[model samples]
Target: MAGLPVALAAAGALAYGTAFGLFGEDARTTAGAAAPAWAEEAADGFASVDALGQKGTYGGRGGPVVTVRTLADLEKYATAPGPHVIVVAGAIPVNPVGKEIKVASDKTIIGSGTSGHIVGGGFFLGPGVHNVIIRNLTIRDTYQGVWNDKDHDFDAVQMDGAHHVWIDHNDLRHMADGLIDSRKDTSYVTVSWNRLGNNNKTFGIGWTENTTADLTIHHNWFRETEQRNPSTDNAAHAHLYNNYLQDDPGTAVTSAYGNYARGRTAMVLENSYFQGLTNPVIKDATASLVQRGNVFSGTRGRNESGGTGFDPRRFYPYTLDAAADVPAIVTAGAGPRSALGTPRAAATRTLTVAKDGSGQFTSVQKAVDAVPAGNSSRVVIQVKPGTYREAVKVPSNKPHVTLQGMGASRKDTVLVEGRASGTPRPDGSGTYGTGGSATLAVEADDFQARNLTVANDFDEARNQHLTGHQAVALRTAADRVLLDALIISGDQDTLLLDTAAKDRPGRVRLTNSYVIGNVDFVFGRATAVIDRSVLTLKKRWDGTSAGYVTAPSTPAGRKGFLITRSTVNGDVTAGSFFLGRPWHAGGDATLDPQTTVRDSVLSAAVRPAPWTDMGGFSWKDDRFAEYRNTGPGAGPAGADRPHLTDAQAADQEIADWLGDWTPAAG
Candidate 1:
């Protein structure tokens, strides 16, 4: 017909595609396991190749992430400038039917679990658009009730003159026209692990005059479709392998053909299974086509091949699934999976907490106490809108726990406590230290907190007699911790982003949130990514003492804190704040503290020389640097101020910080 296409549950690794580099291309699907890195997907095939001076198809990896539910918000972000990782939460109907939303360059539009659907509409990519990925979505219901009637041009995804695009793991059907229409010399594209069926004019590649398109179509199941089967024309390199194309009974007439190569297109078709199809493979006399190791079943008309097509291995490396296992692999592993949005492979159990005796527990801590110890599955402690003046802790044994607030704003549901660092413990164990004074301390892995406020209201101004005023609002020493839309407030040492030990891997991602403090408010040894958030530099309790923002004591050869696309400002004097200083924890010279403030706005509070020595460790001896900072406080790098070059900043990205792990909402 028309067109063709974390376990981290994380096991059963099926081998295929590019199984190298930071991203693994193995397919894994089992109960409580993931279907590859669905939450952290990057391009793999021809789209992953660097061409036209663009570095592969990594859509919105360096940009902020946004979640949209309505059609207007979806359209607003899809056509916006720069890049974004947009999560579609539910079905967005395309009004008046057959309407196509024009998506701009550098966007990753993925589904939130299996609920993201574009109803009666599709997406369109205009000329010169590049680096776009549309994955794990159901784009359907655009049928005009007239398949043979060719009046509407409503396609599931139509791209013209676009480059470096990847369409994967989606359910696209019931379209008015071709399911995927790639025209006007679109190149460096990959279509993998998609199910295309129940229509005519399935896939059409190339309606342009130039032979510039490079496509990799693999592991796609084209079922119950009539024709096209991705008819390629004037393609420079069209590599089709391990594709399962099966035509239902009838509809395979003289005019219907599968895998048509026309107009001098160089095509390589191999290891594909074709069942119950007429004219399974055909090529024009002038085209360069090569066919080998293809399995054909039932009936087929013309499976002809001639001329020597160009080899694809010279361009990029890719592995293929066996032709016999194509049916089993594509059918079971295709479409929008439920585990794509979830971090765990098993079903998540939920527990609610409210203050006024309306929930399962009276306080947030009580709900956390109710969780079964050493639990294997995810447990969500939903907190209602209330201010619970108590401490909350998730121990190391209690992993996969999320404390989500069921409130309209993050300010509504508050988990607060008043414990200064020097406050003596009731158990006579001495004072609660800076790390132990945290109102909310998460020591478990796979932790998440959203739409909540964690504050250590220790009254630093009232406690002028105290010596230690380090009040921590939140301290997390774990892996894969995501804090979204939260407000962490205190005076000094507010948020401690740490690791279990010097050898363990501890990573945290904080986005669309706020962290307010003065002295080393956001400090730790973890590889933390503070993205698109606000880091307000508050005045000290005396209202004149200037403080630092971050004090990282990262281990040697390990990454530290990364604050990107965020704003650093507060109600303080000009040049009163340093970006960060190296903190050699426990006077350990082996710890190399580092902090990078990149693509962020620094108000008048930040000093020109934003880094310095701490605990006898020189900042220059470590990895402290800045890149592309703006606003009044930003300046060029000197001997005292380190700045990262363009090439250097490219290497230190979010992907480099959080390796194979992609943080998701619990």
Candidate 2:
């Protein structure tokens, strides 16, 4: 057994002796089992002066404390409201201790510090408790902490299925489910300023799920807590803000999905910090989202494939300056390399190499500058691999900008690397403020890149002082973009898939390709599908485990990322990856949800608890799903892993996203 605290041990013994003096051996033995010797003694000393029915007992009198020593005694006394404050200050036994004790409405529970703890094996709540507050306690090693089996109950605290409750300044660690939980229609709840760590080996809850509930999670530290299959129903409303999160080597923090129904809707997120781990966030949402002013500086150290991806434009809503001197746009035609080869049957148009002195430019951007807007057919840019070192952009008006390479052999074709500053021009001399270092920026609708490799080979490790230095390989905010046989590599948001259309849904297809990055490097809100592709996860030498493969910020009511028939391989562990999570609190649950990994292979580096929070919002109401994935990370399909039906896979409209191109395979 682990060592017990000295104070609790001494107090328990004294309390047992007092029981012997007051109610004979039966009470003494019960007291002995309830707490440590020291805790019993303290209880005895306090009990001598304390009475069961004192005038100030129920109110906040001189700690007119209601002390229940044993689990049995606690159970007996917890039925009615005898005191304003209840203290469970002992080492409860390891056996089945019945269920949770639902505190009376407006009651408070005071316990030991996070270090000072009690063991609640399986205690549950009674129905219809409201306005309860639980603080400064540690409940651990239990089946469910404060479970509410009843429906429509509100204003309770300290355990599973708590609704309209306030839980603050407590520590819940090493539980099989969630640290705090709620249930059906449970609403108007607030959970703040708590230390929630390592619990729930299974898919359970501490404070969770109110199908029609409204919850607020703020200023709490969720460290090393494991979460799975939180909620898929769109009716749950959640708000998360300004909290500290640390989970480096455990399961993810949150999970969301719409159950059979449309699922929970409405969510908001704001300023927070996450660190000390791999897979910091996720979003499986289908609702529109509004994300603002949050920094994901550290806490993303897994090279696992399906981890972190989202749109940077939505990260800090106020920081978007599109008119800034971003990278030069690449749109015109070059040599025979510019000729794009359509499938044997779908040849809509043939390429005409630009022989005019001014029409032919060395870099891809020069070509883009020459093209006219709104071309009907796709403009193919057949690139020959000698490293076209320049930043390129395809404007929204240009529409089609296809960079076709020699082939997939890697030796014949390569779209070398480069980036544009928020202020700098395409050449090395210019200075672009915020949006620089982007090798390729696509803002045009229906943009496609085949047989090309884009990279940002900037020396970030050279003390460049590039804090928000996004040396991106691609920043795409277009509708219907197709990347076939493409390769992207960089650090800190390498491939920004920004699909943030409020009304219409955009589409993206990444096929037979490879992408590598660090940090929230591959993040965005693109309704994308990565079919038969390879995600290569790279390691950072800084000893910081803070790089995820993907982070999707898919808001409510829009199409999100869909990854299928892919391979996730890297040097990281399975436990380091996050599948997806909600991006905003109280978000539209039926909006675009992040989905991936059907019929795929995820490396062992992907963590089992693959879902976590978006900003501060828990993803219990999002639509994140994975199906029939094989690898060391593969497990039986459960809440976290839902096998997609063949019909559902076909309906996702993946073919249209790949426009005018067919993958080598069926």
Candidate 3:
């Protein structure tokens, strides 16, 4: 009874303390930390209106009007003391990075109109600056649309991070890197309501490293961009809601590192649309993200030798909308992902090839060589079902070339094969290395090879010296390359799904086809979907056969490889084929890249220890994933091989690696 009085007194003191703390309100937490020296004393000088219509530039303080005439005058007033607000009217600025407008702390730059542009370059932010708002402007022709390279970064405009920022209502285009990046810092930022485009290079958002957290990217339009780079894999725990992403014909949109073994990142993508071009979408991870309702239009290209790996959950949202120009589905919220509401002309304009000697030659490759590049009109060479012995090379200049073979993917096969290393060309003064000792070499972007079989028939022993003896089948190094019902065959580097170089990782789709090879043959860096294809390995007499089938040489910062809904078979002895080996030039297996296989069939010929170690290195560093594969080759859980859980398989973080784009099982 005596202790009750003490308890009541203590409770009363605690309540009084809590009330005082709540009423006092820490200024730093409520109004943000101290402003940088470069920032003016107050934020009330410029013209600004609050949500409730209260007007002030320096937070309603009666400050001087920070008058600026030209882009340079704005820069001068930005650094001064008396004027708080910085009214940037007239034309876009010139050299914003070098001048006075260096984005001081605690400031806002509200553009005059959607046409209020940033002409010279993007506004670069230094490290540690906080509390900034940049909105309602047209940003173009900068190194990056909005460049923020510092480590401790946050962003508002949907670009990369700079921390403590608000970026909304802008049209940003023609940049070298990502439109927005937030790979660094635990920045709570909101990037909403913007239009993002690529002037020439890769990515709409470049989320890198492991630091970014609590980011919301919503209601953004990513239209008419080119070549989404593989380095944009750093977006962890990101919310991508109601966005529209589309590219023109021949461009590639790929989401790299979704299945990264370092650990699956969390990405939430809902109510979005992706459409058009060669590779509408590509993913390379087994990430942990949520992609509830996304529509990916257009058929993903077939990999060299045929088939694609577009996952069912991620890629299934893409319905066959015959009315849509790009064969993709339209989602809620955003405008359609593409300018044209439907698929390419190939959807409607079917190619039928018959010759009463009307064309130059009966073969498809010959017709491609006859046509010139930059031809606005398309040339559809309808191919009849016969074994044509020749190599095909479609260069970058030769655009809009479509080769339609006679038959459905499974039934029809127009075969093309070559034998010698230096085969004589039609002009025939010398020989060209079209197939590099094998068959067809397709190097054309925006090129479609439908219902065809491209093969290589080089007898290994015939080429006495193994020095210049690398064989090839169909080497596709083009962006937006589609291989529908295509069959490719050879030994050793057979279907070289290779890029032109390391810099250019193309997007390819291999659907409803077959590829048969031995050794480290099926390999390269192309973001390919080997969906519903049969990969067979013929018997090899040579004891020198490595027996490794697919060697993915995906670079450190690139989307590695994906083999989904396909079959792997071999005629050789069981446990003869090593599923894959790391493709490092120095034979170092430690720098392992990411590779995944899901819902496919395998043969007993595949080794139980699926991954092969090279040059005294462990395979643990390598990134590899397999889900629900059935066959004798897919053995029980062991050291070298691990099974993917149903939850891991369903994670949208990894689904983004497949663009979470799935096509219907026809």
Total clashing pairs for each candidate: 11, 144, 69
lDDT-superior candidate, 1 or 2 = 1
**TM-score for all predictions?**
0.57, 0.43, 0.46
The alpha-carbon lDDT assigned to residue 522 of candidate 1 equals 91
lDDT of 3 by residue, 450-473 (tens): 666566776666555534445677
lDDT tens digits by residue: candidate 2, 300-345:
5321112122332232222221211111110111000101111111
Which residue runs of candidate 3 sit more than 4 Å off their true CA positions?
1-360, 376-378, 408-413, 420-435, 464-468, 542-546, 586-592, 615-618, 645-666
For candidate 3, give the lDDT.
Answer: 0.51
Say which prediction, candidate 1 or candidate 2, comes out ahead on TM-score: 1
Best by TM-score: 1
Q: Which residue runs of candidate 2 sit more than 4 Å off their true CA positions?
A: 1-359, 418-436, 541-546, 584-593, 638-666
RMSD of every prediction: 20.3, 29.3, 23.5
Model 3 lDDT, residue 451, Cα: 60
